[model samples]
Target: MSDERDPSPYDALLLLSFGGPEGPDDVVPFLANVTRGRGIPEERLKEVGQHYFLFGGVSPINEQNRALLAALRADFAEHGLDLPVFWGNRNWAPYLTDTLRDMTLAGHRRIAVLTTSAYASYSGCRQYRENLADALAALAAEGLEPPRVDKLRHYFNDPGFVGPMADGVLTALEELDPRVRDGAHLAFTTHSIPTAAADTSGPVAGHGDGGAYVRQHLDVARLIVDAVREETGIEHPWRLVYQSRSGAPHIPWLEPDICDHLEELHDQGAPAAVMVPIGFVSDHMEVLYDLDTEATAKAAELGLPVRRSATVGADPRFATAVRELLLERAATERGSAVERCALGALGASYDLCPVGCCPARTPRPAAAGADTPL
Candidate 1:
């Protein structure tokens, strides 16, 4: 599968991600693109945009994506995968449509997309597919041959994903003062989606409503904790907490915000803590502001020493994982017997996102589901 002469079934790989502002001027407009139909006021957006403004009005996500792109290209070249990697974002420049146009112009047809989000939720999974659908539709309208896009499966449980996070957690644990390192608690954090969205995360077949999202996170957190325990011989106390909640207060989201969790750990007399941002693939705005800035401040207020581990942005293992996933999918498309790569108890995620998986609140055009591809 790694041989360039063998020819991959897919001609191109698309690195799909959630985009962020590149400059002070791009902050509000980027936020607007993210919250397009939500009716969030400009004033409120400015208030929320303070996170980026604090950092020169730029989001770290774009740079991180660029790094990942470079890493993927390098890995592909080194491994002789012979696939060109293209990048696109959902909410900002180098948009999906533009990238798709470039791919088509280059005469590439079959495409594989690797989204940054590793989970299975409406915003994480379905919304990205919806974006792909929109891009394909636009290309079709322009009389271009819309490519067939196969979204790689959710990789929350893959060793390529978990191994890096485990290493990160270990590094964060080591970063704590030696006196408090043994007593440090692990707070694994992820974006807080609405409870309603949580209720419908995976396929309706085997997994009950919303079970896939929480289950995958729990599995990954357990895997990381176990990996850390095996290496350091410390069974650190840990809990999965949510962050970056954006819905109206009245509407319920995931409970035990990272800040509140820190308070609880402090109350429990935990000497220090390590934040494992297992939910994200990179240190984007949510991670920078929510965890590094806001959560760190709260931990300080509580006198709880804390360290945030690095995200798997452009980690060689992660880039290699992308290549492996692509080949795995290509092998499946070719009807070849290939070992399904995964770690943890739940096993490898389904290659084809099943029918009724990650159902959206409203009907929208989505690609690469059980029946649709675009």
Candidate 2:
């Protein structure tokens, strides 16, 4: 079905995301919330939080998300859809509970949520659901009606999403030195998690189980690669890689970090390469540190030319894709099949998540308080 066939059944759309600190004073506490269960020392967290401090303790993610919210609102208005857009973060001001409370008070029910993460994993999928549950419980205590929120399916495969990425890759290719551009290898990078966690992601299906996190990323990478080839008529070599692995050394995470991959490309006599952060929505901390800072430095040391493609931050096409996904989800009746593209040759259809499909990992602390899933 097309997006124009039906407008959203949802009363409002929530821009859900991982919030970042806006100032030096907010950095340590925000980092603390993110690493709450990890048992990382406060001093160490403070040191690590220096990445945010480098940029005046501010993260570009929140601002980027705000711009996205505006774009979404504009798109909805332009298309004559009445869905109101709201913003909430897992941590920080405009907390999920508060935002949901505002929406509830405003008489919005049956909301639709769009999480910032594009892939499936404990952090990306289940954890957010758990947060939603926590929010509902909090609203119950406050004697306020909690709105039912249905999250839109992941949009990693939408033409609106992949098309912008194709443009980015082509732009990067154009920026490279002519010699390097002709022989450039493409390296697509994303967040790394414990291999075991990656293996158990998504819902169980007829194939025995759902696609794992790594598999999902590979699927998106393949689509983007193919799209790039089709668009530019250049079959540049590419590989899906992992970055931002914070797990202990004993635990295995995804392999061959971007820096390592750049070295290998250099050794292989590749003059240049384009690093596409297909796994992220914007140049978040991982993209900033791993690709722009660290990977670029490594490439410079190796004497290999490298350019990084931009993420779909505030891109009009991406905003339109989000709108289309919302309309798609809302138009389909509950328990009915909805067709959606995945990363592979075989497309799949999914119903809305069952009640307990994606369960939350850690039990939310009582002191953290309950919140509505905005």
Each prediction's Cα lDDT score?
0.89, 0.78
TM-score leader: 1
Q: What is the per-residue lDDT of model 2 for residues 181-207, given as tens digits with 9 covering 90 to 100?
A: 867898999888776666656654411
> Ten-residue segment with the worst summed lDDT in candidate 2?
365-374
Task: Write model 1 residue lDDT over 279-360, tens digit each, in one string.
Answer: 9999998899999999999998999999999888899998888888888888888887879888888888888788888888
User: Which residue pairs show backbone clashes in model 1?
Assistant: 199-210
**Which ranges in model 2 have alpha carbons more than 4 Å from their true place?**
1-8, 205-211, 334-351, 354-374
RMSD for all candidates, in order, please.
1.5, 3.9
Worst 10 residues of 1 by lDDT: 1-10
Off by over 4 Å in 1: 1-7, 206-210
TM-score of each: 0.97, 0.90
